[model samples]
Target: MSIEFIYPEFEVIRNESRCIACRVCERQCANEVHSYDPERGIMVADESKCVNCHRCVALCPTRALKIVKSDCALRENANWPQSTINEIYKQASSGGVLLSSMGNPNPLPVYWDKILINASQVTNPSIDPLREPMETKVCLGKKKQEIRRDENGKLVCEMTPQLELSVPIMFSAMSYGSISYNAHASLARAATELGILYNTGEGGLHEDFYVYGANTIVQVASGRFGVHKDYLEAAAAVEIKMGQGAKPGIGGHLPGAKIVGDVSRTRMIPEGTDAISPAPHHDIYSIEDLRQLVYSLKEATEYKKPVIVKVAAVHNIAAIASGIARSGADIISIDGFRGGTGAAPTRIRNNVGIPIELALASVDQRLREEGIRDNVSLVVGGSIRSSADVVKAVALGADACYIGTAALIALGCHLCRTCHSGKCNWGIATQRPDLVKRLNPDIGSKRLINLVRAWQHEIKELMGGMGINSIEALRGNRLMLRGVGLNEKELQILGISHAGE
Candidate 1:
């Protein structure tokens, strides 16, 4: 028995008086929500088909279109909301696990909003960034314990392979199969221009991007997609993808529909085949096994590039990171629960991992307690929204932060949460030729560069206000942060005190 239990989620409104039947909306929308009706000589819409990406609304030549959430509601019940009931109904019909895109949209506690930053007052006058020399440059890798002098009395400066960034922000991993080639090109160009790095997300580096290897971080996941000796050696650094924030314990699944053309070649997989990365690396059964892989990668790269171990933030993340720090990895990247992805199971994305703020604080404290904080650099990410979030993250103890969702937004993502549909109208997340062409790499790269450059200025201004001149000075300075509306337990977990304390 079929049931019509719910109304359309989004309603489209068109002003007939203002509309001229130009049909620009029809051409721009990839979801086919609008169609021209020759019989009525007017444009018509199917509201049920709309994801409310605002593509049609943005491209409407007559400025007569708008999308709004439908006001219709189910019987008011706090115990079971409409979304919960809808998911149950959907699963009953489809008999498959519900899939969601991007980050968790549930109303969870956002620690970043609850935490606050402190500025210098008359006691310690704030430095003006314009007149003072403020440095945002950061290096990601292990640092020497102490300076050593040779027998000739000359200093011996020995350091591990490090990735130098002009800013403390980098574009997080977004695979070519999940996003488009134009999107990858934009990140590559932006990273090059910004003197930062962009990750490949285990999809393997495209041949065209080899020239940007200086600003690239190639990833090797359980799938071992597009992995080769040359691929390992081509990048500034290599990352082992142990887990992802969106699907903490789950593996990656690139559907057959998206595995075509260059995607198949880059992934080193057959066309029209699903690329499934197993939950755990087959060869890794313990921490020692992880150490083996880390050293193997170092050997394969001829000890020239740093090896990073990335794991999702979880309950025992501090212990996990502690083990990884001693496992020969030069850097550790921790991802939080709110991290974005092209597709993830709804259950895992919403309920699996902890917040990055808590994880970063715990890991930093543990590493410091163990006296191994300098063994590896900590790069934190999941949802680093702005320069303020970056400042907060560094104060909470992150050498650098990754910006995934923000980078996508810079490339015109409307966050419709329909990236899994493979019909991204903005051309940032789709592989369809028509949709892909909508994004010009040249313009996209410039926009990305502009975003990072603006953020660098803001970061400098924030640092200046704190009376800090360099990122190294601000790296683990938790004293510059205070908590608001957070309980003692929350503040303790974040290693910060309540505001006005």
Candidate 2:
């Protein structure tokens, strides 16, 4: 016997007087949520199929539609929430592990919101960013422990390969198969235009994007998809993806259905076959093994490119980062729990990792205490929302910040959390030709460029208010920050004091 289910999550409201029966909603909805009734000559919606992406609402001609959460309840319980019960029912019926996309939706503490920035008041007056030169340019790489000089006494400036950014923001990794070609184009063009970098997330670089190699960071994950000697040589740097924030210890799986055409060729995998990335690199069992791979990449690139080790932020992140610093890696990228992903198991995404703020603070402090902080540059990602976040991340000791969700939003993602379905109507996270064409790379690139440019201006304004003229002066300056509503342990971990103090 089929049991009656709970209420639909969303309720679609369409004004009868304003809808005009234009059928625009019917035509635009990729989920088949809207249908035109021949007998009634009206547009009707199937709320059960709605993901609430807001595409139809935005495109509606007469402001006739709105979607709201259903006021339906199932005898609410605090300990066992409605969502938990729903998940149990879903699992029992389907016998499948629940999958979700985007960042963890759990209401975990976002430290950036708790932390407050300090402004110049008396001793030091704030500078006018418009009139004064505010330097935001940053280089990500190891700093030499001691300077070397030639026989002529002229200091030699031979430093390892470094990534230079006009702004302390970068478009984080989103692979080709996980997203569309147009999305990659947008990121590549924007990175080149803004003089920053974009990461090729474990999905090997497409042949067409080779021209943007100078601004790209090629990733090498456990599956080692799309990696080759030429791919390594073409990139400015190489990143070893040990773990991702969304699924800390889990592997990545790009379903066979999304694998086709260029994706198949680029990843060097068979068409319509699941591209599974093992949880751990078979060859890397210890820190020593990690060091070997790091050196191997450097050697493959003729020691010209710096290597970055990317790991998820977890409870023992400080200790893990310390080992990576000593693993011959020039950079360490830590993804916080709130970082975005194409797909992750529902339980792991919300319950596995720690916040970026705490991890960054602890890792920076540990590296400094070990006198190895200068050995590797720290880059943090997992939901850097605004310029304030970038400033806060730097003050907490990050060299720069990576923005995945923000970049996708710039490219027209509505954060509906349905990315794993591979039917993104916005064109940012789908492989379908028709849906992919909806995103014009030319327009997408411009929007992304505008976002970073606006952020750069705001970063300068924030730095000016702090009486700092360069990003270097603000790096790891915890005195410039204060925490609110946090206990002593949290404040201590973040290396900041209470807000009022």
Candidate 3:
């Protein structure tokens, strides 16, 4: 028999005398921190395996479990906060920036909560999804204004070739190097099976995943890692990631420790070198320069696949999105401040960018006013926690939704947010071979399918309840959405009145 132990940094001291023994801690803990043994007749915790995620500490009955700093102490420091002191120790020992993965776990405003959802009752009767079919399929790309026909009534030009997805949900950008081979395989396989798309991020596509090319969306970022002619043409669409939502106005860096072996070879960059994506495209200081890169990729690919330009939702996101729509980009993906990242500077991750809800609404309104809403498809991401968020995103003018952290959770990620250390216990986001092997692609892919299928059904239900039969009908249907507890400016911008008179 083998036993593994995890010495948690935080320890829970349970005062049994104060414990009501109601098992509230057991019920609240997703990790099963508190277990009640009938023989023992008391709640016991296996502290060695506890993640110190605070699930039980927050819900203990009678406040019996008082979470405290671990008794294990380091060299004392007189002048620093506990967290700062620990950070100094970490840097002194490893000389590396503390890194974390997934979305920003720090407390931030989740606009979805502040906003509200509406349902039909006495006025327009709600339709039941169980009775009839509802469509969640969404097409991503340009839509033409009016049709033109020749003398023979043949069409001159139609809408740009959009990627027809079976659902409005897509797997977000996660590079091969940031994630493992098995993880990539699972996403590719599941994307193919679900009739959705998975992004390759900027690390380029693995040769093994080329078989799933029909379901892939390859990325071309500032670093241009592993990008070649074949990488450009071998996907349904190409995304140029200008910035990410987690750290807007900042670039990305996949540290040297993670750049090893296959990840090294695939990126075509030197091993042990920090893979740095500069904040600004070196040649692009203006919108014209942005267009240069956009058209460059387009001409190189012969306009075969739709080009998507993804930008973080910043304060000026509306203007930026409008420029992208006119830059010959067939699609614009806006990531909100709450979006996840493999690694980001703490300052940037916590205090940068705008909410995705506001960004999506503002961008759509700006594009529509400019008569350019049909110029590109809009895909938004950043803490889209459930199917309800997906429904709201489409109604707010997004063509589709992108999901990242949720997908990882389905594949067994605990949201430990320690991916930057390259020592993830779960296989979802690390280059370490031992840790990477933990995720079995077959099982992971199946789980991903199950998650998406469940959400697909929920999407259909949400649409049916809104008296909408198809996803197309729900797209940009602001009339069906009325903001609650929102200011007048916010209501005006969202194009929906406040809920109730």
Candidate 4:
């Protein structure tokens, strides 16, 4: 055996007693892991290609197939883990940067898990969500600091454009090319039905999805691909994606193989050509430069659509967000280091940015200190796993939360972390026609709706337990949060006290 031959990470186990040899697994697996061994008169698997996506197991009529992590190990070393050793071996052979999909799998501290929400005890009583009203609805945009009266003593009701969400959650950006057309269709349909919004990543809005424009936030990234006046005007809002949490400083890259037909036409790029976004927007070098483009987009959209500046949560994110707020952006979306992406360099994805909890709290405190808290709305993302995370984020000062990985999971993604390969077995991240057809938008959208609605109900219940009947009251209410296992510094940055105190 070649010394360089690393064992396959997963093993496919077939139960001979239950095996019908129907070849259903072979036909369903896009990775071609299963095949019929005609001579042996049984179906066999080449486990090397298995991503452990569970597609075959789900489709097997006899339930004979199962994929399990191989119990393979090397000399265990704390300084050099098995995955690290294997990565070195693979990189030595491939001579290329390692890529990964989905969110960081590193064992970093999740602040949401460490923080506990406060519930009513004596003075303030908890409200029953079923018996009383609870408001999860949120509006994302600039807010007036004070009410002004006209000469006739009438209040000024004029305000800038805002995104009205039925729940304090919106589906984050997942470009069409990075995902499947049916996946985008599912998100668009679910967002519209739920009275929220979905971002059209850097990929241009597909012509077919123009009908869902009311629930869309078209993005303008460094590449500015597929962006035009019509594209900007077709959405409820516009997002300038300065950076993403997964690959903070670097831009995006969609392999040419995935860019075919509508993906090419929508991105306005030639077919079979790599779509590489520049690291920085050549037109934006400073905050002043960003302000110019922000105003320009507003002008092009006739000042009707709200402009959002989405940035990764980095070391100086508080200062960066303060600048964005002053740059006339109606909203600032912060993505933490754990955020998901279609693909990102493994090193950057694991080690670049800060947690969204720290970033959101610091930015909110900074804005409030500067008396510009109401200037622009705050939205945070990067691994908002459940309704509890949503509630904690609001208490940490986020006006709303953007969910990407969670939304994709609702549409049948197994988090195999192989999306960059463009051969998703679940039909959520592939461009192949055969694979794409596996996901029915009708079913996908319905599942997404169910997931979000369930979260909304939970959000209301959490709020009711806090004696807070509205999300607006929960916003920036750090007093309602307390840390459990966090250190003093983390607790300070998160603007919360210890659980006991």
* TM-score against native, each model: 0.99, 0.99, 0.84, 0.99
lDDT of 2 by residue, 1-501 (tens): 255375689999999999898888887888889999989998999999999999899899999999999888888799999999999888888899999999998888999999999999999999899999999999999889999999999999999888899998988888999999999999999999999999999899999999999999999999999999999999999999999999999889999999999999999999999999999999999999999999999999998998999999999999999999999999999999999999999999999999999999999999999999999999999999999999999999999999999999999999999999998989878899988988999999999999999999999999999999999999999999999899999999999999889
Write the residue-wise lDDT of candidate 3 on 1-501 in tens digits.
Answer: 122222357676889898877897776554455788879788887665455545466556477886665877646776664656656666676677666566777656676766666677788878898988777788899988898999999989755768989999999999988888899999999999999999999898989888999899999998999899988888999899999998889888998888888888888888899999899788888778888888898898887789999999999899999999889899999999989988887668877888899999999999999999999999999889898898888888999999998898888776767667665556667786766887899999999999999999998888877788899988888887777778898788777777774
- Residue pairs that clash (backbone atoms under 3 angstroms), model 4: none
TM-score of 4: 0.99
Over the stretch 39-132, how does candidate 4's per-residue lDDT look in tens digits?
9999999999999999999999999988999988898899998999999998988899999999999999899999999999999999999999
User: lDDT (0-100) at residue 119 of candidate 1?
Assistant: 88
Least accurate 10 contiguous residues by lDDT in model 3: 1-10
Residue 309 in candidate 1, Cα distance off native in Å: 0.4
What are the runs in model 3 whose C-alpha is more than 4 Å off? Answer: 1-8, 12-98, 155-158
Q: How far does residue 253 in candidate 2 sit from its true spot (Å)?
A: 0.3
lDDT for 60 (candidate 2): 97
Instruction: Provide the overall lDDT of each model, using Cα atoms, as 2-decimal numbers.
Output: 0.94, 0.94, 0.84, 0.95
The alpha-carbon deviation from the true structure for residue 307 of candidate 2, after best TM-score superposition, in angstroms, is: 0.5
Question: How many backbone overlaps does candidate 1 show?
Answer: 0
Give candidate 1's whole-model lDDT: 0.94
